[model samples]
Target: MRIFLFSILLLLAGCSQTLHINERYSASGQNSRVQYIVLHYTSADLNRSLQLLTETEVSSHYLIGDRTPTIYRLVDENRRAWHAGDSQWQGRTWLNGTTIGIELVNQGFYDTPTGRYWQPFAPAQIEALIGLLKDIMQRHQLPPGSILAHSDIAPQRKVDPGPLFPWKQLADAGLVPWPDADAVARQQALFSASLPTVQWFQAQLMRQGYAVPLHGELDQATRNVLAAFQMKYRPARYDGEPDAQTA
Candidate 1:
């Protein structure tokens, strides 16, 4: 009788432990409102990136390797990952709540003449990124312009997934808008003779979903927003100044 009681107690304890483990693994408490997919470059090699993302608290939903176009899923899509730190978009802060971060392996930026550094993104990696992005966008019902870079949300401090990223290629696939060349050309003509009012340009940028101050002054905040915009829409020249074409 004593042995039987002991065995029953052990069985109940084991069952309780199993139930707790199963509850922990279940998705009862996970976030479900994933809306945006943010892209980033690891600025490190594949192995290092994998190790850091897996071991460290910082993580992303997916990591795309440089050599091959394959994507490694690090975090589940339904759960929130620890990425997009100190970010803001369209007046919303802390983008991690609504975004899925995808980190690609790359060296990021390199110095060049004119004291400007350029970053190189591999063509194959970008191609792979497009497919992954398409699937995520479809799953989340993300809009055409919903796809964003790490730098786009954190322009004040971060610059990863830098200027070399192929926004045009993504736009070609109907992922984002390709600024109307004709509209830009017309704006360029108007801007050449005289710079448009700072307020006018700011309004256009705001209309395009950039967070610009409405003060009508081309200040640092405005410049940062313009630089981010130019990097995405007009990659050829991201001088940050409201030049003829940018204006």
Candidate 2:
């Protein structure tokens, strides 16, 4: 009887040790570390997108397919994804640490005799993305403003989720805020008389969450940022020129 009891005690102790190693106590009122949702275009079809995002160094948390569309979660939300390379937003830099990336299977753009023409995302794909966005936002308690475009964060080197992206649809779904048309029209008129100086444009761009140089010069860097902004807000024309409409 004594030897049997000793074996039982040893088994219980081992079980307790395993439990201690596997389980942890936690406090309440804590949330996920996810702070932002960055959208991108895969620039490839379903098979190619899966191949690149899954097997390559670049990856996103989710990928929305095109035809026969569905949202494929490539990376777990708790883990950091390799998207958003050399990126920034507001005052934060290196956004991959804090953002969840969602890539849509898209052709991105094709050059034409007129200009570069960007392809539009499929309606079904966008719908799937909206549902995924809602789930992520609800779980993370993120606001509409936290949803961003890849181009918005990395203006100089990246332009995925380009002009044809349906930002207005997200805005309509209350997932993102859109610039007031009335206000833009008023500002456009005001600036038309005399376009703001390059310094003012830089300041406004910075205020609007773009990381542009404040050197008061329309250099290549400044043009790149302006083009990025126009790609999001004024997609009809993003010539990188500081005109009244873009101002």
Alpha-carbon deviation at 93 in model 2, angstroms:
1.1
Q: Give, for candidate 2, the lowest lDDT window spanning 10 residues.
A: 18-27
Q: Can you give the lDDT of residue 69 in candidate 2? A: 78
- Model 1: per-residue Cα lDDT over 1-247, one tens digit each: 9999999999999888844344455656653487678988897889999999999999999999998867999999878899899888877889888889999999787667767666577899999999998998887777788888786888767766777888899999989777789998997897898888888888988786566788999898888878887877677877688888877
Model 2 Cα shift for residue 192 (angstroms): 1.2
Please give the CA lDDT of all the candidate structures: 0.84, 0.90
TM-score of each: 0.82, 0.88
Clashes of each: 0, 0
Candidate 2 ranges beyond 4 A from true positions = 1-16, 19-29
Instruction: After the best TM-score superposition of candidate 2, give how far the Cα of residue 156 lies from its true spot, in angstroms.
Output: 0.6
> Which numbered prediction scores highest in lDDT against the true structure?
2
Candidate 2 achieves a global lDDT of 0.90
lDDT of 2 by residue, 1-247 (tens): 9999999999999888844354576779787789999999988899999999999899999998999778889999989999999988888899999999999999999899997878888899888989999999999999888898898899999888998898889989999988899998998998999999999999998998889999999999999999998888788888789999888
